[model samples]
Target: MHLLFIADPLHSFKIYKDTTFAMMREAYRRGHTLSVCEPQHITWQRGSRVSAQVLGITLTGDPTQWYEAQPLRRAELKDFDAVLMRKDPPFDSEYFYATHLLEQAERDGARVFNKPRALRDHPEKLAIMEFPEFIGPTLVTRDAQDIRRFHAEHQDIILKPLDGMGGMGIFRVGPDGLNLGSITETLNRHGAQSVMVQKFLPEIVDGDKRVLIIGGKPVPFCLARIPQGSEVRGNLAAGGKGVARPLSDRDWEIGNALGPVLQERGLLLAGVDVIGDCVTEINVTSPTCFQEIFDQTGCDVAKLFIDALELAISAGD
Candidate 1:
């Protein structure tokens, strides 16, 4: 299969722990040619097909230089066997527009993994609301009064901006509610921005586990991103220590329940963030942790992903 990865720049990848690099390497190992492009490379002229400035790359085993690639060439998006939207987010307006172009590509018969419309539909933070049983008591609002009410009821609550990633702009308001008004102002922007408020789970001290779902089935192992020192955010990017572990019963239950359903909904890959027994987030836009799990547990996540991708492509054919 010839795979085109709509991702960040090839030179910017930290290949050591990057899951997109992991997928590219696995696809190369399986004798599939791979091309890469940033989301901004996409273009759709008035009557021409959706196209992109893409570069076909060969994997180099060298650690410092991971890929050997040619110059960017314009290519029709529908020409590839699969288009993998693997860009990490701020998921801002630019990302939103890229999805529209990909949606058009899909209409031109491009088989994109995790589907464009699905990505647009399931905004990571908002998607959790659908599976209320697996999450803690949560509220979404920009109104200061509503947030205060939720914090008053929950006592200890977590506050976060809806557009944040890597745990940016997250706050914890306890019984004393220190900086509550200020934090609300910063996050909600005087009711112009919406933020998510959830009852703070005591179980976060254990670890925030990332359960990978490929082809709607949960991987047996997960990366438990343990918070270091006083930091409350357990994201690896936020200085959390990633430790791979077997899935707990609750982890298994949540992953299994969400996996097939999300797949049926056209999200082929997902990283469900599990804090204790409850799921905190469903990562659809480039879900990660493939390398951490494989390095720690030898679970072969990349292979599983490629196998699933192959199956999906074959099914489409």
Candidate 2:
């Protein structure tokens, strides 16, 4: 089978922790051809079939030189056996445009995993709103007054931009509310942009768990991102400690509850974020932490994903 992964540039991959790189390695080991292209490489002019300038690639043992690419070739989306959308987020206008192109490919009979429309429909931070029972006090608004009201209602709260990833733009305002007005303006652009405010989960001290759901089931273990020093964010990009452990019962329950619904919606993989028993985010676009859990637990998450991918392909046939 030939697999085409639409993702970040292959040269930019940090193999030790990049989930896309891990998937490539696992796929190559299983004798499947691999091709890669950045989102910008996709082009669909007047009469074209939504093709891409894709480069066939092979993996190397050396981490620094992980991929060797062949000359670029243009292929219609239907040419590949599977297409994995593994682009990281800032899900801005460009990212949004990429999904529309991929969705056109899907219509042309390309099997794109974690389906494009699903990605657009479920923005990470606001996705948890689908399950109010699983979330804490949350507000999504651009109004400074609304944020102030929410903060007043919940003394400790977290404010963040809905499009932000990797702990960026996250601020915790406590009882003192020293910089509430300023933060509201900065995050919201003074009533122009929307921002999210949720009650701060004190259980963050324990860890912010990333529970990966693939092919409609839980991974059995999770990578807990524990905040460092005075930081309130438990994102690995923010220098949080990644500790892998077995999934807690509550975690399993949440995963099981959401898995089937997500699968039905064409989301093949999801990384559900949890602090204590409440889900804080449902990461559909480029959900990560596969390597961290593997390095600690010896559970080959990449292999699991590949196996599921193969099954999905065969079932599609």
Q: Local distance difference test, per candidate?
A: 0.92, 0.92
What value of lDDT does candidate 1 attain over all alpha carbons? 0.92
Error of 2 at 295 (Å): 0.6
Candidate 2 on 1-317: residue-level lDDT in tens? Answer: 99999998776788889999889889999999999888999988877788999999888777777778899999998889999999898899999999999999988899999889999999998889889999899999999989989989999999999889999999999999989999999999989999999999999998999999999899999999999999999999999999998999999999999999998888889999999999999999899999999999999999989988999899992
RMSD of each: 0.9, 1.0
- As a TM-score, model 1 comes out at 0.98
Tens-place lDDT digits, model 1, residues 87-203: 999889999998899999999989998898999999999999999999989999989999999988989999998889998989998999999999999999999999999999988
- Using Cα atoms with residue i matched to residue i, what is each candidate's TM-score against the true structure? 0.98, 0.98
Top candidate by lDDT? 2
Colliding residue pairs in candidate 1: none
lDDT, model 1, position 87: 90
